[model samples]
Target: MATSSDRHRIRFTVHYDGRSFHGWQVQPDQRTAQGELERVLAKLTNGPCAVIGSGRTDRGVHATGQVAAADVPLRWSPHALRRAMNALLPDDVWVADAEMAPPFFHPRYDATSRSYIYRLGLASEADSPFRAPWCWPLLRPVDLLAMERAAERIVGDHSFKAFAKAGQEERGDRCTVTEARWAPWEGIGLEFHVSANRFLHHMVRYLVGTLVDIGLGQREPEEMDRLLAGEEGLETSPPAPAEGLFLTAVTYPADAGTKPPRRRGPQLVP
Candidate 1:
């Protein structure tokens, strides 16, 4: 339970299937996760409600633990508001949980780290209709050792300019990658898990594409070193298919939903 305050901030988690929506952000004449949420919330709040998400996932990128925040009228408790919104939202999106957040909670600003997992399937059955929507079906084995070696370089702070899409350098292309690793999935090819303070547009997909190519022996593993050098002359492979990407979690300051002036620990690690 949250005590009364000058402002009422609501924090919520959502899990959405991105196939039917344009992306996380609202766009003109587009179906988006944020748009759907704001619309339903506005109806419930009986006013214009703005829902701010932790990140802007690309089109067709799913999220199992997307975090967001909003300000609603003081009359509504967190549980009631969550139920109301869930009742009105479409089937593709589900409000996993909601809570009364502290007045100062801002979804994006208060987040300390975000984690994403990219799934790939190597078996011929990976291309099955049932599996294609969730994972990349390569249908052929890739060199896991090579990919792991390349991923090791991703740890630590560095300029990810090469892995991100262009036109974003205006915001400066840098991210602190605390963890980047590859692991075998349940009878699937592998899943790439990368946790970072922040990610640039298409950075994860591009890194996956390049790493896959390295596994295929199309590129050298040291290319990651050159790309992070922040100099020209190296380019990453095409971005991986968006369907394989899932935003697994967003790590916020522990005190994010408690009150104003959120307290944060060091970025997530280990």
Candidate 2:
């Protein structure tokens, strides 16, 4: 139990390659971001500490701007915490920044929006070995214009029940998607950017799969409205590969910080 005087809140950011991790949350017998972080925090503070993340990411999901918060009795400078944690965490996970936050602040509840980026390579050759672990490589050609048109259909608030995966029936399927678009990137790749108040499990990937189907002529763009309108008979889309997915950014109230820190190399844990 926490005593009144033991209350101390800290905020931090983490970057991780989800390919090597089981997921962000700690699980029994699985190496996860939360487990690694808690281990380091316990060693540093010489006691148990609970770390709360802004969101839960699935296996093989990557995050460049994941945020978490924890309460601990030990008081260490943010730089020190950053250095110490980086040393203890594995090379695949890096601590970007750590700072004090209002005691009432909670990473999950305080977040205003979250952004995700999905990359699709439009080339006949396989992706380079170095980039293979972080991107989805496609050899088949994709119709870029068709993908963009289908993507536009998902913008705005709607009941996304059809897009949601099975076993999420208890939670309503309404989601307010503020932005959804795909744009050509440099060379032979395209990027899909989506921002929302909240997301259903595998929502972005499902959307990507749906649009990719449209690009491939497997489905008509007009089918999107029926899908959104709770129509049945439309086939479920396949989730885009996890490697190309990244949790890019999370927004909070302005007072949380004017800007997030720049990405840097991993620090050594104490």
Candidate 3:
């Protein structure tokens, strides 16, 4: 049991635009989600605080359900912590919700799966300044059927070495893709949705770029198989732009931690 002054865990979900910020992780003199959150938390806790994140989202990648955990004073209720933290955070970043977690809880290692979505703007209207921040506007139409077929091939356990960036192979490139699909986006374009046990660096963006290439007839759909098989020396298309990607959710087993804390606004469900 925690004493009155003892430190326990607090888990929170943060939403960020990622357009102006450097990324999720902290870097010296760089504006980042984690950096800002840690700053405010340190002030609130009245000392140094290390905020651990579910993972590092690349620069320009947005997230609606990015999970992070930190130890704070035992008296800081999840609701009060969120309200206080949001008061000091900039408009681009906000704590959507928070929960009290076990001392052993770790956002990244405890996650059962992580989900991401890539939005493609197929319609010409996407060029509007208002719509440019969250989507990739394609100037030319591509075959949606081909993209769907390629997405189907991605639903399984695979090495994915070819899809990841160089040096990511040190941890091994295997990922178990439990769910993967392409769906229409409100009659405007298509979006790729995928959930995996783990992801290698830049794997999803690479997959999206490769699938888009196949849709444009730049490569055969069968190339997905070769990539999964870790075929050496076959290069992939350039990664999809970071703005098109969003971390939609993260899942954890019920036993992984404690019940979610109460909140005042619409909760960010994971």
What are the lDDT scores of the predictions, listed in order? 0.86, 0.80, 0.85
Q: Between 1 and 2, whose TM-score is larger?
A: 1
Q: Model 3, 1-270: lDDT tens per residue?
A: 211247778899989999988889889999999999989988998987888888889999999999998888887999999999999999999899998887566687678899999988898767668776888998579988888888889998888888888988578878999988888887768889999999988999999999999999999888888888868888888999999899989998877645433323211111
Model 3 score (lDDT): 0.85
List, residue by residue over 110-209, the lDDT tens digit for candidate 2.
6889999998877643377766667677756878788878788888899887887788878788888888998775675788999998898888888888
lDDT of 2 at 31: 86
Who wins the lDDT comparison? 1
Count of backbone clashes, every candidate in sequence: 0, 3, 0
Better of 2 and 3 by TM-score: 3
Cα RMSD (angstroms) for every candidate in the order listed: 4.9, 6.1, 5.7
Q: Which ranges in model 2 have alpha carbons more than 4 Å from their true place?
A: 1-4, 124-126, 255-270
Ranking 1 against 2 by lDDT, winner: 1
lDDT of 2: 0.80
lDDT of 1 by residue, 1-270 (tens): 232353487789999999888999989999999999999988987777778899899999999999988777788888998889889999999999998777666778788999999998998777888888988898887989899999999999998888888889787888999999998877867999999999999999999999999998999999889888965766888999999999999997677745544455221110
